[model samples]
Target: MNPSASQNIRPETVAKVRTGIPGFDSISEGGLPRARATLIAGTAGSAKTVFAVHYLAAGITQADEPGVFVTFEDSVADVRKNMLGFGWDIARWEKEGKWAFVDAAPDAEGPIAIVGDYDLGGLLARIEHAVKKIGAKRVSLDSLNALFVQFKDHAMLRAELFRITSTLKRMGVTVVFTGERIDEYGDVTRHGIEEFVADNVVILRNSLEEERRRRTVEILKMRGTTHQRGEFPFTLSSREGIIVIPLSQIQLTQSSSTVRITSGVKELDRMCGGGFFRDSVILASGASGTGKTLLVTQFMSGGFKAKERSLLFAFEESKDQLFRNAAAWGMDFAGMEQKERLMVVNRYPHAMAMEDHLVEMQQIIDDFKPNRVAVDSLSALERVSSLRGFREFVISLTSTLKQKETAGLFTSTSPSLLGGTSVTEKHISTLTDSIILLRYVESFGTMRRALVVLKMRGSQHDDAIREYTIDGKGMHIGDRLSAITGVLSGHTTFEGE
Candidate 1:
């Protein structure tokens, strides 16, 4: 095909500020707008200041763009001290004349020249001096709340915000102004100072639920470029600085190795679509003695055999009891742990805070980069946290697993009281990507277990509920129980048709 007339016109690439957030620039379609003021608004402790400082740090280290950080929340020394977590030597950077820190409150007492008889000229002149001194290209005001303390009227604060942004933009200085957001899940705050003035708006929100807390960053608006619109999960570490884990971005490499994992039962793999999906989440639910733990052991060992790392988080069983019981079923978890491919985490339901568990889980993932993760039963986690918290926990777990492309096989013990269908089952079923129910069906005067697929998103499987059996070797799906009378009564009488 010949090049069209429009194709002949090549567009120039616009300059952007590299924000230093891992996987973030990709979400922004490159980076933040250049020479424009961007508002990073959030409540206290939401890491807004850290993000702003890290952005400036990236400008200094990656782009060689000198930066000026004007703080209202912390002193220059305190700012430097806090940045130590990122392994950034603020003193070294300052000494090199590539960065400058200014405390706004200290300079406010000076005899100042008011720009146009309304603006803060002293602050502007100080900023200009710092910019010219080090050829700084970027600036960040720690927070606008501190800047607003002097102003009693809302109208004046908004005007001043506009003037400051305009002055910085005119100087070709890309700036980030951190502000406090009072309202959540909405545009701007009550003051509306940042919502109207800045060229770009970025919101960082910390959503607290009964089970977990999530930190997210969203680009509300970017003036001249296309950006991703999603609440991307972000994390700040003592070493990694800031990173955003985007969910939809699939990092599939050029390889389809048909990565096989043992499904605890050899026959169960044949029943499933050739083993559980690599890096997928599997929900296994059943009544007691359905061999959920045994099946999980087999799955974990499969990962070990494949030389891929895996973790088993047991909420109900003690490590010793699990080893002893699983040994009887031919699962050698202790042996796998010795090989360093498998890790067994045993925690009581009431022992640890749910938040600490999340942090620990992430740390393990970061350290191991495991191919498989198993939570023996989420019901234990649910017991410790509130319903809202449990939802957040599920979201966090799913989000993390998806982002890392790690397979997670979890169990949720369904009470026999509710049978195969009930509100409790429905609640958990809605949260998982796939649901596999194991239940006891009374047939021929005997209690038998059955396996059924409640749902499997993005894949098709058998719809029939089949008979399942557990023996010394492990769990297996048997032929459907065909002969039974009054099976729903929790008791069965056999009769020929």
Candidate 2:
């Protein structure tokens, strides 16, 4: 047999170890550098310990890789019990020889001191024994600050820290060392040496903003690899260990569909040049009580009638309210839901952070895999997020929906009751593929609803402002209001008057 030339080719890539934390791998461009030491630093209650533990647990459960946790602050029993609270059965894993704990905490009654002549050889030996016993591929040294506190001399502390990190790297095990930040605003550790000695540095922060505590994670440095910059919001829960939401890292190059889908309303579809393109984003902006929610319901109901799956994410309206409102217009939302063709999810915007809301939405979309998705109002989401954050959210969300090839409709409340542009409208106009405007027009002394297709990319749309009515049969689009002049400016005068 002749030797193949492909057998000797070497990959020109740096090896990485998956942390298994949600969004963490994506932000890190893969994961932490393999067989390298990473320093996780943060202040009290910043979840440094939990993050390290989750990494070890994930390695064992998801990668089929054994791990060893060397704790200097918590005992083995304490660590196991605490992990159990997060539904991680570390004790069971230990029994199965898939995980092991090396307790390095000082005895409560014993005087603890690292004499100037002493080295970390004893600790190193213990770690080596545990790793060899379990054939561990991952390790975590919790609270390296605890060891620093025992040492009096700075030189000795730095030497010991460097020695520990170097030895762990030589052991060929991916390692994480937790350290307490000196202050809230700085990434330096208590001894200010851990950051310089480790191959990777991740800082977790829990700070007070607007009288509320927000948790964030940042990759301060990752040697030999590129990583996502800026701070990303993260959440910790009992069931889900750590979830990092990287808003800036969301890719915008989602695949778009050229196929057009119906708008459900025949006249409206005609105005939009047949229908909207599949995987396109449509922004329906209007004033309060201008039937924005009704339009969304119609869009969703249209999907249901076509036997296409739909998901409605209602922020301001309750599920019952949505059902009743749809029923008033002769649409059976509850029936559609019963048939599993529709999914209505109601959320209180103020109850959670904007990042958390986005994460939840992504999870639901992934699980339901709906053909059509609607967010009743983006104004509520805008209110929950800062201006910059809202813009980022909309871009990230619309891009994701397009990537999934799902048609998306987002409703926004205009500040003006009459025809006028809003800041939000201006910001999102460029991000969306189409824009539909609904306004209130006053003719003589009567108030009426008017609709217009302001912009539809790559398609011809009706330019005239048509009067619409929401009655028992839902929105009825009449002929263009040609007899009325200045309708867009709130006051409309009859053409011949």
Candidate 3:
């Protein structure tokens, strides 16, 4: 007798089981394959057990699906206590009959001796009973290597793995098996055969980059579905569990805004072809004391004045200091914040990783839903990440803001004090929709401020460098400084000299 056509259909067409972890489903191209075994491998302290617990917790809470967690390393009570720290009341879930645990950890008193030929039949039986008891749709066998370490024969270990995985698949329960990677860069599992037996494999890495610990996740293999194929940054937080930052998957679809938004300084707005597009990214680049932060403040203040919500990420200043500086220029930043029109987030650059900063910004943008955002200074962030990483982050951040139709203004500090040039100008200039240069011109034996629009991708802008003044009333753009040549180069000379 032949099987039905549906039986021969590819597994990819089957519906996926959503993991309910933030950003996990999106990066997995939905979620884990249904009714299949997935191997979660990592080194010590890599949060492998924590990841498994989260998977089960999410299934029980969000998917209305009962789950069974079979731990071979930690006791059921210990697992419960650890999960409680993460705000997951696994004990309560057990009482509600939504989840169950199989404690197969070796007794602390002594090791069990198995003299006869053995298989995982007893463990499989316990799992089957738990599934039948709670009607579980999800299962996790954490630290699968704990059971393998007991057997000396590699063939027996592989056979037991195949049996357990095949039995779980026949039960029609989506399963996750946590294993420890033996070498720093070797097989996904210590035994080297689990990865081959599992339907999917996800490797979690916690490595030091520049003496800072970085956590990343990569899908090594997936049998039926196409998953994102790069190592993406992830964070394990007490409140949100495993949150992945899928920066590599960001789409670059250009989202345009026909409406032009003011830059607060009326003359500067006029110079940018009547202000900036609503969803554009503007780079305000200059050296130290060139008023880059002030330009960002004015742009944010303009959004506040227009009744549009604004967010300011201050890397170098506190909220109070930013408010004081804005107040010096006649802008009431505190009042705007009090009115809920503005929000200022201050974070020291050294306090967190670049990926952490990206996650923070993503959360704030989601919660605040601001119409405008300003990052007062990318140079601080560059100090924390690699050049390539920084560029990727800028691209991801700007692309996300553009997709949300949020106008973003970012400040970059030129290394030279006399406006020699900026590395950021060469690197990030293409990612932005417009480039606004703030510089100091050395003309007539004195230093004077100048402003110019170097590039605006989709709009015409004034090419002439205009002199500007910063005072109690904020930036004031005067007539174009057509008399000075090399204004951008700091060594300016009279045009007719």
What are the TM-scores, per candidate, against the unseen true structure?
Answer: 0.76, 0.91, 0.93
How many clashes show up in model 3? 0
What digit string (tens of lDDT, one per residue) describes model 3 on residues 37-67? 9898999988899889999999987989999
- Give model 1's TM-score versus the native structure: 0.76
Cα lDDT tens digits, model 2, 338-446, are 9999999999988887666776788889999999999988988877776766776788788779879999999998898877776678788888888898989887678
* RMSD, one per candidate, in order: 5.6, 3.7, 3.6
| lDDT at residue 286 of model 2 (Cα atoms) | 91
Q: Could you say which candidate leads in TM-score?
A: 3
User: Mind sharing the TM-score for model 3?
Assistant: 0.93
Tell me the tens digit of each residue's lDDT in model 1 across 1-497.
Answer: 22221232444244576676776786776677878888888877889888888888888888898899988768788899989878888789899999998777545465444444355666778887888898889999878887676545567768767777788888889889898887667657546766668888888988775545567788898986667897876777666577765544534232122454555566566666566666567788777777778778888877877788888888999999988887887778788888788888888867655544665677777787788899987877877876754555666676677667788888877666325443334565665656777767765366677776666555556666677776787677777556654433344556764
Comparing 2 and 3 on TM-score, the stronger one:
3
Residue-level lDDT for 449 in candidate 1: 74
